[model samples]
Target: MTGLSTLGRLAPLGAAVAAVAERLRPSVVTIENGSGAGAGVIWSADGLIITNDHVVPGDQARVRLGSQDVVPARVVGRDRLNDLAALRVPREGLPAAEVGDSRALRPGQLVLAMGHPLGLSHALTLGIVSALPTDDDERELIRADLALAPGNSGGPMVDAAGRVVGINAMVASPGLALAVPSHVVADFVTHIGEPAPWLGITALPVVLPPDLRRRVGVAAGLMITAVERGGPAEAAGLLPGDVIVAIAEEPVRHPRHLLEALARTPAGGDLDLVILRGGQGHRLRVAPARRAPQADVPPARSAA
Candidate 1:
């Protein structure tokens, strides 16, 4: 391919990629915390953003808009299991990114990653979807060959049409970058601000004794270290030393597993929990109540 011939062949593709990058640039923001900084995608016009849970690890973060103006943002919610987090900025009328359906993505489809990689803002990398990994429950993930770095975490991965299909999570290897699918991001944002069921208890994962494991038919369980005063757990006669074996028939091994089960439980709905207290396994029905909103500072600043 001669240089002139190559230019003629590649110019159109280059122009398309540039257009997509331009459209997505304004919707991508820099998310900074005490430790470091990453990228975030504007998820709503009213300043709701989505980023990686690790990027916004603290209770608050500082979001820098395209104008280089920084604003304080509160952490609305985090789903560490899915490695996604939501933030509420103290502003509105922000330009949210155009989200597309990841389920419609196909291997070898052209995509672009827009974010700050190696602290370079508005960096764009082009690649094709290498694979799509699905979990047992049909949760999908995008695996691309895009070059990404630390600062690319939480950035938007948009298709050639400039529609976001996923959020760049991490570089799995030299050239493979993994992204949390867009459908999961949409679901996370929808429930992040809503009041879900709450069973007030602090617990940790614990290995069951051999005999106890046999009795509970599990290798591990969550040990309730503390039951909140006047909370649903206490109301259900759950003691601090109780070990949770299952919830709604699903096996509970990790603390997050229990949390996922609780999140699916409807407010004011009965939850059947199988627990082992004092080496005695028993089942209890508890009605989970709506979670009380935390006393966090409201969104008060404006930068839009």
Candidate 2:
């Protein structure tokens, strides 16, 4: 009798979840690349698909529509900074997912994670918004407790109202699923097919120890893990293992801050950077250059 009552109480909630899944199923798609397959969401009725840059590693990928139609899709744009990429397929009258403001999301709010996880087609998982990245993070990644798998990399995280709020991007340790907020996705779509300035470096944000923090006069800094040869960063004398503490007098604590500071410098213009190398500080001026096409240059890996 108690089990029957508990089942009765959960029936409405189960039905509501099922309804949302059915509503967003058509807009979700399977994106297959040379590496593997992931999920993507249709962002426009004219066949614009939004996915993760990691999902579509190269310039093009194969998109499988809901009707089981496989078509070759071109990479319209990829913003490696935010881990979001857009694709264009030759089709019309497609179902577009309704995007919602991620800023409006509250902690503990019910959300649905839709994706094709572990080769399973059209999988739906439930969870709540665990946390939102602080302003300093810049990427606006949404942290949720949703169960995610390898194939869920580029799917949509929809709200109870069936509005897409974020795109599943990566999962962190200790069971946290991260997604790129919809607002960031919208910005990437706005500048689709446009290339941004590139400062060829692979960096990771690191927190300095108490003594080092006091010595560097900052709490955090970006550790230059890799400096591209013949690139602007290398030209500026930025070597691997150097810790960048500031840019043009502004303290840079994260990769986003460094990127924003670098974006302010025009092509061929100098950006004064303060780097701590070997327990000493050195100021180096770096000039950023316009990024080349996907075929010409390697993408700088900075997201961490």
What shift in Å separates residue 211 of candidate 1 from its native position after superposition? 7.2
Candidate 1: lDDT of 270? 81
User: Could you estimate the TM-score for every candidate?
Assistant: 0.72, 0.77
lDDT of 2 by residue, 1-304 (tens): 9999999999999999999999999999999997899999999999999998889888889999998999999997876777878999999999999999988999899999888999999999999999987856646689999999999999999989999999999988546899998887886686575566666887877778899878767887888998888888888888888988888788877777776665556666877888988878899887777764333222233622
Candidate 1 local distance difference test against the native = 0.82
Tens-digit per-residue lDDT, 178-256, candidate 1 = 9998987887787876876677777767789898778657887778887878988789898888888888778876655
Q: Which ten residues in a row are the worst by lDDT in model 2?
A: 295-304
Highest-scoring model, TM-score: 2
lDDT of 1 at 20: 87
- Segments of candidate 2 deviating more than 4 angstroms: 1-9, 135-140, 173-175, 199-212, 223-243, 247-250, 261-289, 293-304
Q: Which ten residues in a row are the worst by lDDT in model 1?
A: 295-304
Q: Which candidate ranks first by lDDT, i.e. highest? A: 2
In candidate 1, which residue pairs get closer than 3 Å at backbone N, Cα or C atoms, i.e. clash? none
